[model samples]
Target: MAQITKAGLTFPIMNSGNRHGEVSGEPLPILMRYWRARRNPRDIPALPQTVRRATGLTQQDVAYLAGVSVRWYRQLENGVAADYSADLLDRVATALDLSPAERATLYLRAVGRPPTPYSPLQEDTAECWDQDLLQLFVDNQEPMPSYATDLSWNVVAHNLTLRRWFPWAAHGANLMRWVFLEPEARQHLVNWESDWARPFLGQLRYERAHHPANAALAQLERAILAGSQDARELWHRREVVEHSHGAVRRLRLPYHQGQEVTVRMVTVRPLRTVALCVNLLVECANPGGPSAS
Candidate 1:
């Protein structure tokens, strides 16, 4: 019998008669050696055990929650089944209460690739704002850097003050993408780990959970995951947090001449509507200070 060991799991390969059909010859041994040479190890965790441990659920419980028979679920866990359909895997993911990262892992293990990202259904009642309303909002936020973003953090509009400050907060710029993918962001953000990366990613996770099927958001996530190793690591952590308001962040501006500026970030929703629009404002921490620039 031939065997393949990979990722801490061992798979036994069935042996049939040698193709050369020479018993007591070099052909059989050579074929076995060739099979052995093909074996490669991977670093992925064992899927069954990972799901079991993470969800803290029994096999029976998972089967029940997934709306599948216990025997089928057992076969899945034991890796005896040939393959599971994507829909079945999705059901199992829900049953296990998996996070987005965990669900991605499950799909990778079962299908040898991540599941296709879902695109949310478009609603007919999307809110509409006139240019005057938007302009008025921007005009009122003077001296302070302020911008408006849609639910997915796409900067729909911004004041000149914001452009003067970040320069990267251009129309259609995604806040998450800018923070995670832009090299300039790393230089400008003093506390990238705690102040910007964690909270921003946490808020992203929260939004993703709420709008998992948004195609544009999914594409942006894919881009971010591909662009930055730090973003990938933080994303897999699956830390979900509510959006923070009035948070203070330290920044190193190009014009600040080696002085770190402390700015208070304020996040607000212009209308009390889900997935409508949000506004971000940055103000100086110290009143009447040069940092306000």
Candidate 2:
């Protein structure tokens, strides 16, 4: 029997049962390094080569687009495991116009973890809604109390009934901002902190987490945190709700003697326009009494 020292640990070598081999004129009962380990033979390869080549963008171009320094982005491309945040990696993925698979590979290799689900490139919040979509909701004869919002929670399309319920949406407004920052929302929505704002905050947090590179969503979060003290405090709570679909909320109906009504919020997304959310409100319970406010 033979022994070897490696990294301060003694490793026992194979005994005479080992097949005979001689090297450097060593004896036939060869002293084999018993604790030998196999290692990855190939070096870490450069990442984003396919994406960068396909986009025909240099490292500087990508760094400029991703809002990162060229040196940092170059290290990222060289497959260096730096302390890059998910947000920055997301930005790089967007800059390279990486496909979902490419982005997954990039994230897995760089960060040792898969990224959040694929998000389509965030569009400008000011983009016009399709005329058909507007007509189907805002101008349609459908009596249902419905409203539509873009990813930024802007009330892009809404009917008279929804406007009647939420007067601010009558024109156009960011719904989450209204929920979090508006004085009127605080007054009308029952349990503003627990019932209304908390879930909305959770939804906001959820969206922002999944779509780290969405500039519009990021701006919306910043605005919410700046304007609402309660939102700022509650934003750190460990909760994340994707949406409030099918949840019943109590609210004082607009211009209806401030009638307290429980409405079930039904949220639906358009297949063609995946970023649009159409929310329909069904009055589930209407306790006839003076408003809670």
Best by lDDT: 2
Please report how far candidate 2 places residue 206 from its true position, in Å: 1.1
Residue 255 lDDT in model 2? 65
Model 1 C-alpha lDDT versus the unseen true structure:
0.61
Clashing pairs in model 2, backbone N/Cα/C closer than 3 A: none
Candidate 1 residue 180 Cα shift, in angstroms, is 1.0
**Candidate 2 global CA lDDT score:** 0.62
Expressed as tens digits, the lDDT of each residue in 7-31 for candidate 2 is 6655433221222421112211111
Clashes (backbone N, CA, C under 3 Å), per candidate, total 2, 0
TM-score of candidate 2 against the unseen true structure: 0.54
Q: Candidate 1: where is the Cα deviation over 4 Å?
A: 1-124, 280-282, 286-293
